[model samples]
Target chain A: MSRALDRTGIWIGWAFFADLANALALTFGYMFSRPVTMQYPDKEKWLPYSRYRGHHFLKRDDEGEIKCVACELCARICPCYCIEVIPYEDEKGNRHPAKFEIDMARCLFCGLCEDACPADAIALGQQYEFSSFSSRDLVIGRDDLLGKPGKAATGGGVVSARLNTEQDVLVETSEPQGYNWWRNIRRT
Target chain B: MELVVALGLIVFKVALLIAILLLLPLPLTWLERKVAGHMQQRMGPMRVGWHGLLQPVADGIKLLTKEDHIPAEADRFLFKLAPILALAPPFVVFVAVPFGESVSVLGTEITLYVSNMNVALLFVFAVIGIEVYGVIFGGWAANSKYAVLGSLRTCAQMISYEIPMGFAVIGVVMLAQSMSLLEIVRAQADVWNIVYQPVGFFVFFVAGLAESQRIPFDLAEAEGDLGAGFHTEYSGIRFAFFMVSEYAIMLLTSVLAVILFFGGWNGVLVPLPPLLWFVLKVAFFVYVFIWFRFTFPRYRYDQLMAIGWKVLLPLSMANIIITGVAFL
Candidate 1:
């Protein structure tokens, strides 16, 4: 009986003080600690990674010429079938795309298009904020893909000026051929 | 003319108190979310307006606009009455709550409280006891098994906890030698009751958590098992009413705890006014409530009963005996 009473006393003491102390300690610890939220849209605006695949853009050569041989490899390899490359013979007898359209509404952003491109013409750009008002606005045509200067796409797809800022920072240095391809395209 | 003027003053005071009672929950809900968020190392709401200051406003509007859904087999009259029943008890309890010392305004001494009863403690307990009926009725009228089970749990939890809670108060009443909340505050002018009856205070605080059906004791509305418990069938503004009452009772108990233990509005060597001191004390207890909700996991139903019965009740009874002997 005495042992039971002693055990009860110990249990009660532990329950009262230990629980209160633990709660108070945790509360104060959390109060003093820095909040972990990123406060998105305003602060911490850096892109995720160098190789992070996002919106697709068509490349231009140093002389302001389209580099795509319109091999249709991207269209073939695309799991979502979002890319369409219509190859036609140009005035220089070189096969180029007459129309390059990517239904971004269907894009998986898998970076497969970038990997499959033989001429290094189509590459994924680092732009993730792409909410569109309509599905039609999501379809990127030849001029939009070519990074033309004037027309602003309604969806938060990266514009030419913004793309220029991200170009040097995001392109992987290990891929010398892709890096040189991107460098030559931006010179004009 | 004097009678008319007194009646008018009473009416005005009641209206003002009702408005405050109704509106306090809006900001409180937002505060609870923010506190819970910060405690967990995450920011709660930041989208609606400047750090989600307008979140409660948005929530109020959304609740108001939602379809008022009633289950097909529900007892419509009882279902409709339950939310109002839940809401009324807290306001009634607040009538006897003395917030601060009287101040003379325009040559008329005005008390901050709505009504000062000689048996204020009894009045608070009796009115608050009626609140469980709302839960039970809400559950029974819903005609669902989960709702019935939830209300049954609540009924048992609340009824069991009230014993320890009442005993804790009895210890304080014995110490103060008065039942009036105002008089209790006055008794603690020299020193707070918490200094004398720390055990009583601890017991009361724990019991108060169960009484308010807060987390760790919130088996009634345990989302995992009962699906929002008693208020499962309630929707839209009706659901908002139930939620508001839960917060109101929480505030009331915290305020009561302040008056009972912390010496409401009584501060030494403080330049701040008595009302501010009282409010700050109440706010501290309220923060503690939110902190506990965030930190502790919910208690299993049997463990909750065991704590209330085998732990708090016996402890409070011992505290009363100790206080009585010390007084002798």
Candidate 2:
């Protein structure tokens, strides 16, 4: 009798209960709560206390000069090796990089490259909506690679520890990805 | 003046629920894409709205503008009729769902529901059962073996699950002593059906999932094997209607579960209002469904059937017996 019960009884019990419970819980418990979506550019997303990580861009100087000295530190430090920089001499014998490229596709946003940069040239900025039609479009040139100086980063890879509060930095340190799987999992 | 105001409030409440439910599926589709994208370590739907919130809207417009294609060999009437028939039945079900209790509207009493039939529960079940006809017709009209087979599988799965679902709901009816959903909810003022009949809750939940044709039970549109399943030939706004119906059913099932198991907005202390608590509970289950969709792989057709038959049906029958004995 127990065996029969276990086979048929258990299955039927779960079928009925789980279905009703799931439905009830969603409708009564959470569905009617204010939907978490905010109208973007018009309304700000209350993104759980400084967890918003925007697009990855390198930092620029106050005078709008590219901070990335083409030090090749970002390239060397990148795990995916998506970053490529060519340090060349100009006609005036200026030892600046002739070609600088950062492939956004392969970037892990690990921020190690920013950390490795000696000149404080590379910084991942806020502006996470980096979308493109082709792989070629996603690859950032030297001019596009840099972040704005002294700007409040909405949150993403390689944010300045100074701009963020201690707790925010601590959280960021704990979760290097900034937006882990859990935070992004919005329950509909 | 009082009657007009009361009627207006009822209309407003029903409209609000319908509007919210209708808009929900679009975001669900977007979220599915984003979740799938992140899971695969690739960004999905980056362009349209911020993080693709507007992606569904774009898709809606795009689908609407697309050409409606019907094969020459297909039965023209049913081909045109299939998606609509498939779509309309589920959409019609919200008429009976009680979203909240009556409140004073312009000094006139009003109910939060559109319909208050004594047989509301039966009406919902009967309507849902008829939804299969939509699928069958669509499949038969398509003139493709794949579509026919897909529809047949869907019919079998939906019909098989409905048994356990119906039985599970019976347990709640026994306790509430009424088939009327509002009365059932009102019956659980002190104790929820869930506290006494957990087994019934489980059976109903699984059956509901299958009924919604969600993941783990979504053999209806098994893309890899069925190539969009029964609606393979459907296009344009017609296809959109089918999609809308699917999400609507999902929302409806969620609402039903809340009503039956979770005390249906009956709490010890009504601090923040019962309605608020009700919505929170419903959202939790919706998230779980989303979570399941994200986390689990689709079940094979045979395995799904075996589980429904060998497992859910019998278990629900026993649960009814258990509930009966416990009450006695």
Best by lDDT: 1
Off by over 4 Å in 1: A1-13, A42-44, A148-188
Give every candidate's TM-score on chain A. 0.68, 0.55
lDDT of each: 0.84, 0.75
Task: Evaluate model 1: give its TM-score.
Answer: 0.88
How does residue B323 of candidate 1 score in lDDT?
A: 86
Per-residue error for B37 in candidate 2, Å, reads: 4.1
Residue range B107-177, candidate 1, lDDT tens digits: 98888887889899999999999999999999999999888999999999999998899999998899789
Q: DockQ of each candidate's interface versus the true one? A: 0.44, 0.04
In the range B1-328, model 2's lDDT, one tens digit per residue, is 9789767766787678668767888888987776555544455686686878899999989998999888789999888877777776776777887867876758856676787778889989999887888788888898988889889989999999999999989899999989988999999988988898788888888889898888878899988898787888788888887788888788778889999998877766656677887887887777667766655568998899898998888989998888889789
Compared with the true structure, the alpha-carbon lDDT of candidate 2 equals 0.75
Residue B235's lDDT in candidate 1: 91
Which CAPRI quality tier does the interface of model 1 achieve? Answer: acceptable
